[model samples]
Target chain A: MKRSLKQFRYETAESLHIALFQIRANKIRSFLTALGVIIGIVAITMMGTAINGIDRGFDKSLAMLGYDVIYVQKSSWSTMGQWWRYRNRADLKTSYTEAINRTIEDNPNSNLLVAVPQMSTYQASVQYRDLTIEQAFALGTSYRYPQTASGDLSSGRFFTPTESAAGTMVAVIGDDIATGLFGEREAVGNIIKMKNSRFRVIGVFRKQGKFLGLFSFDNQVIMPLGAFEKTFGKKGFVTLRVKIRDQKQVDDAKAELLGIMRRIRRLPPQKEADFSINEQKAFKSQLDPIKNGIAAAGIFITGMSLFVGAIGIMNITFVSVKERTREIGLRKALGARRNTILMQFLIESVMICLIGGLIGLVTSFLMTWAIATALPDFPVQFSPALVFASLVVSVATGIISGLAPAVNASRLDPADSLRYE
Target chain B: METSPVITMRDLKRHYSMGEETVKALDGVDLEFLKNDYAAIMGPSGSGKSTLMNIIGCLDTPTSGTYILNGQNVAEMDDDELARVRNREIGFVFQTFNLLPRINCLRNVELPLIYAGVNPREREERATEALNRVGLGDRITHKPTELSGGQIQRVAIARALINNPSIILADEPTGNLDTATSQDIMEIFSDLSKAGNTIILITHEEDIALYTRRIIRLRDGRIESDKKQ
Candidate 1:
């Protein structure tokens, strides 16, 4: 009877069992053989996981800017002090911002909410009584500033739009500014002096975490836009901050604002706007090239390691074939076919690699998990694709290495082999 | 029924060349052995007894001659065909009792059947029966290292019989054993012959040859004598 594929499978299984038996009988040799594959798997898996985590973290940070939000600034991209170049040129002043906001609010499809015009200037050593903080950023914002920025409030209320319109001298202090001025005591409703003017603190914000160890966003203070214009003069440029009814309506609101700005500025048709409208998603798209480069490098390095493991497998299988020559001859003389002999050796090679691959896979998973747990914010998502790829790599390695030995086994002359002694 | 000759060879010439000279290991020898015969091939060193045994066992091809075994022209057959015939029709017991080191006695016996494409369940049943026949059924799970030299040879005999081949060819099956152990193995061979299986043994010892019913003596590459005891 012709041997079915099932029989071949059984034979291969038996051969694998025999191979494992031999390995178990020689423990140190087997471990040394599998070492290269283990190291390769660990390197590839860990690198992939780390890169995935970083990608996730970048996305989460971008999502913080609300997917629906768009910024309309004097110069393209948000950066401090870029308006100086446009200084002599007509800056985005309060009049233009007021005109855009009023037009958008009058439209039937208007989803704009509490549009605020804001500006900032850098100065060092702002003092309160005997205490002085270095390099304080002086922000001039409308009373609706808290609504646009969304800084977490620790205590007291934010300034209203009415307060901003009336040019009130009220301020909403950040956590750091309040602590610096009041020294842990209640700074709410207290008067702090800034730029030779008195401002009353109506609220103190919670901590905004560190930005390169300079000061948190919570370290700043808020005041009515009109109050800043009244005190410092109505000449500074303003960037418009508008909130939509919801995130979904942000695109419509931005379109309406753009149309209003175009009409108010009177740019001819077919002319691009002098200002820039930027989205957080644009920054994320820029990171793609770096991600691809890292992925390619990881694959190349891991492939080299897998190759080394394959070489090890080939070397060991060759040694096994040499050692088992007599036994192989005996089996052939007793009636084994060429394919039978070939499959036996091939199964042995695959078994060796499979064991190594399994160990490597488990070790890589544990390593990635341990590293991710150790470092929280730095992303490391250990994906199953990496694991599956590692397994495929190992199996392919086994097949490549086993090919030579299997051919040698099949090519042995049964007549000569019987007398091989 | 003991009828026709199971093996028939005519002018079998097996020659080997050593650099420049030709050596005829089996020179123009004609021989025949019928079924159910227990025979012995005896000769001194360099007497071509082992060469004749190799041809008869289908392990080697004669240089030139007609070798008809069980009415098939095996001398004309290819290497693969000869291997198939050998696996189907011959059981060989070696001087070293060549059992695979890593496998147990039962697996060793199942090796030949495995190559014959036998199902595992049938292979196991047949192997167990063969092991039982050789008086090593209880020790089937034991490796060769755990067994005595005589027991290993018995396992080898069981392995040879597992496929129920046409003949049991022993090339000095008792060579590695002591006198008592050799006698025990010879007794097994005698019992196998009585049970209707053909037995062909190669040996130089006169006492070992005495156990066979027929003896063929070789001197240099020629048949010196053929006698039934």
Candidate 2:
């Protein structure tokens, strides 16, 4: 057994050397054959890169939503944009946040942390002296708002508890709001006009990029909920942001919050609550199917191109076998077994594919870099796993394409092949 | 005491079916060769000499009768087993000097040992020794394309002898060479035979057959004569 294994190794080594020599001697033919694999690998790697970029961008957006936070609103994020289901539902009251927070504070073992009630309107406008910014997101929250969110204060401070309770006309402005209304001027302590009332800009938030390249977090004006009610009306859009003790316990936290909200609404035991409890995971569940759909379609299309490429390789390998008939006869006469001939052809095709795969990886890496440099917002990534997966695919393609020809070469009659003109 | 023959054939037959007709390529032929025998098979173009060479080289199987090489009945062997028999028991020299043109002389000579599963160091050593024996020791690194016809044939012969097989089979070994280079190749074969290597070759030229100690003539797939000069 050991001797056979040693012999197999020697034969494989000899085949590899012969394959290399054949490829080197026929450089143009080899490269042209390898081009099929090159195109296939490039398509595969680029597809993988695109999918990776989409995932990376989604993860970034999820991070901005704060993984540890969940939201209580009228419409669920998982069923997002299905406004008809939530249209007839009553608005989620901001006062429910206080009740939830009170229960969390009393229970020592609760997975719930803190809840911040938020009210906002996108139609609100802010004016500072002669400059005005329209369609700015005007939000209302309390002293605990920063705990459930991600951004940090760039200047001044959030409203103190006493100020929040007093309904003081003090606000924390977003980076875009501050920059738009003041334009490099000190925004803190500056008073801005909104809806016939003046409110002091107590703080400005650091710049936070957009979510999924759509909604901007930097364009908001956050103030005390009580103060926002007098200006934007009490019935404006409302959401309750709840911070959980651990993100891993989000399901438990959501269940706990659901019970709390049901009690706040005084719902009967048999009746279901009208509100929705949501987390970042809801967005994932909603988007994952779409993402998978894109991936499945991309893979099929890419697989088709690779299949065409493999057929090309198979055709070229057949021609190669036919061209080397005399050499095959000679080798067989000298002592090459059927398996040795098969292995020689197989190694040749596989070597070509491996080289093609490496070239494709390097090409995709450069293309990814160039794309990132040209459009910094474009989501595209090159990963080592992608490299590994594509190489395996290349090798499989080589074997699948080489098998028929190699077998034909192996089965050639040594005596007859020697006599072939 | 007389020793047993290294090669023995009993009623070997190879027939080809040609469109409803059976062409008897080799019909009921029998032969024997002792160890260190130098022989040539001579016949005309459709005389079954090539068929005999094919069967002797283990490249083809006979339809009937047993062929025993060194006491092993190789007639019934399967493809892979026959390959092993060829690798271990036979060396082949062809008319075209069938050296792989891309590889150097040393690599070409090492081809048989590779199939025989010899390790690299030993394969190189044995191949070098065989090449040196064939008088191409200085041209080990030269490709077939770089060497003369005589040198290429010597490389083929070295490859043939690398495994030290029981029989060296050459088919029309000098048919494509000039008279002078043919003499050189025959002289190398002569030297190999004198050194106790059993050698067999097939050719139609009597002058080429003169180099071997014995010659067998075939006609219409039957042995016509066996003569010793």
Candidate 3:
């Protein structure tokens, strides 16, 4: 048995050498056969990278939403774009924060920590002398706004309680608005015009990239709620930002907030809650179906390419067996076992597939790099797991496609094959 | 002193089915060959010389017969067992000098040793020695395509001798060669036979048959004459 095992090893080594020679001798034919595997591998790895990038990009976006915070607004984020359902509902009031906070302070076991009111619009414009920026997001909130949001002040401090109470015209501008009016220079202490009134920049919030990949969060102009009402009117749009003690208890907090809002709205048990209690989870739920749809389509494209590649490999292997009929007979006469011929052909097909897969991986790497350089916001991730997976897939495809031809070669009658012209 | 026969056969028959007809390639032939015996099998067209050579070489199994090679049951052996018997007991030299064209002389010669489970270093040493014995030592690195027809035939002979088998089966080994090249190959066979190896040649040429000590003539799947030349 040991001797046979050793014999098998030597036979395999010889087979590998022959396979390499054959591939080298017929370079063009081998390359043409490998092309299918190349394209299939490229499609598969690129799709995997895109899916990974989508998942990572979304996680980054969701992180910006502050996991521990929930929003009390008239429109639901999960059911967004169907605005008509909530257009007839009464507008959410900014004072609702005060009521929610009062009830939370009354209960010692409340999951709610604090609530801050935010009233904003996308239509506000900012001006500095001759330069004017339109479509800037202007937000009005209490002094506790930083507690419910993410940007670190790159310049000055947040508005004080005294300033907030006095409805002072001091603003902590976002990074984009700061740089837009001030250019690389300091904007703190400089006055910018917002809707005909001049407000001094107290602090400049750092750059926060995009919000949910849609609009820039750094283009926002934040100020005391009173100053914002004075300029944009008291009735633009309102969202009550409530911070919960534990993110894991967000559902319980949402229920608690729902009960408080219903009592405040004077709603009975028969009616649905007029306002939508929203969170980052609602956005994730909405994004899941779209993500799944892309993933399903990607899998189908990958499967189709690999299937075609397998068929191409199978056809080429059959041709190779036919072309080498006499060689097979000679080997058999030289005392080659049946498995030896099978292994030789299998090795040939597998080597082609492996080489093709490596080339495809390198191609995809370059493509990912180009995409990353061209559009920095668009993510493309190529991971080690993906590399390992494609290689295994390539080998498996080779084996599956090369089996019938290899078996046919192995089973050929030596005498008959020797006479094959 | 007398020794047992190296090959024994009795009523050996090999039949083939072609649709509705049965073609008897070999029919009820019995023969025995002693160790170190050198013989030629000759026949005209439609004769069973080629079929008998195939059966003797263990490339084909006989139907309804008992044939033994070095005391192992060849007729009853399965495919794998026959392969092993061929590897250990028989060496084959074909008429076409069927060397793999892409590989060099040394690798081609080492093909049988590979099947015999020899290690790389030892296989190379033995293949080089065999090539040297065939007067092609310096051309061991030359591929079959790079060599002349006679050189490729010598390389095939080197491959055949690599395993030191009990019998050398040469089926018209010089059929594709010129007269001078055929003389050189026949001379090599003469030397191997003198060195105590059993040799079997299948040929239709009288001159090639004359090179052997005994000639067996076959016609219509049956032996017509066996004479000591």
Candidate 3, residues A187-224, lDDT tens digits: the string is 99999999878999999988888866898889999999
Native contacts recovered by candidate 3, as a share?
Answer: 0.75
**Which residue pairs in candidate 2 have backbone atoms (N, alpha carbon, C) closer than 3 angstroms, thus clashing?**
none
Model 3 bad stretches (over 4 Å): none
Worst 10 residues of 1 chain B by lDDT: B77-86
Interface RMSD of 2: 0.9
lDDT for position A246 in model 3:
99
**What is the two-chain DockQ of model 3?**
0.83
> Model 2 over residues B4-121: C-alpha lDDT tens digits?
6989999999999999999999999999998888999999999999999999999999999989998888898887888888899999999988887878999999998888889999
Off by over 4 Å in 2: A99-113, A127-132, A178-199, A244-256, A259-272, B1-3
Tens digits of per-residue lDDT for model 1, A308-350: 8878878887888787788878877887667778878877777
> DockQ: which is higher, 1 or 3?
3
Q: For model 2, how does the per-residue alpha-carbon lDDT over A1-421 read when each residue is reduced to its tens digit?
A: 8878988999999888888888898899888888877888888888889889989998998898999999999998887778998988888888888898899989998999999999999998999999899998989988998898998999999999998988889989899999898888999999998888799999999998788888889999888988899898897899999999999999999999999999998889898788999888887887789889988988898788778878888998999999889988878877788999999999988888888788888888899899999998889999899999999999998899999999999999999988877
On DockQ, the stronger of 1 and 2 is 2
Q: What C-alpha lDDT values do all the predictions have?
A: 0.79, 0.90, 0.91
| Better candidate by lDDT, 1 or 2 | 2
**Highest lDDT among the candidates is held by which one?**
3
Candidate number with greatest DockQ? 3
lDDT for model 3 comes to 0.91
| Candidate 1 docking class | acceptable
Q: Which tens-of-lDDT digit does each residue in B4-121 have in candidate 1?
A: 8989989999999998999988898888889998899999999998888888888778999899989888888776677677888899999988898767999999988776778889
Q: How accurate is candidate 2 locally (lDDT)?
A: 0.90
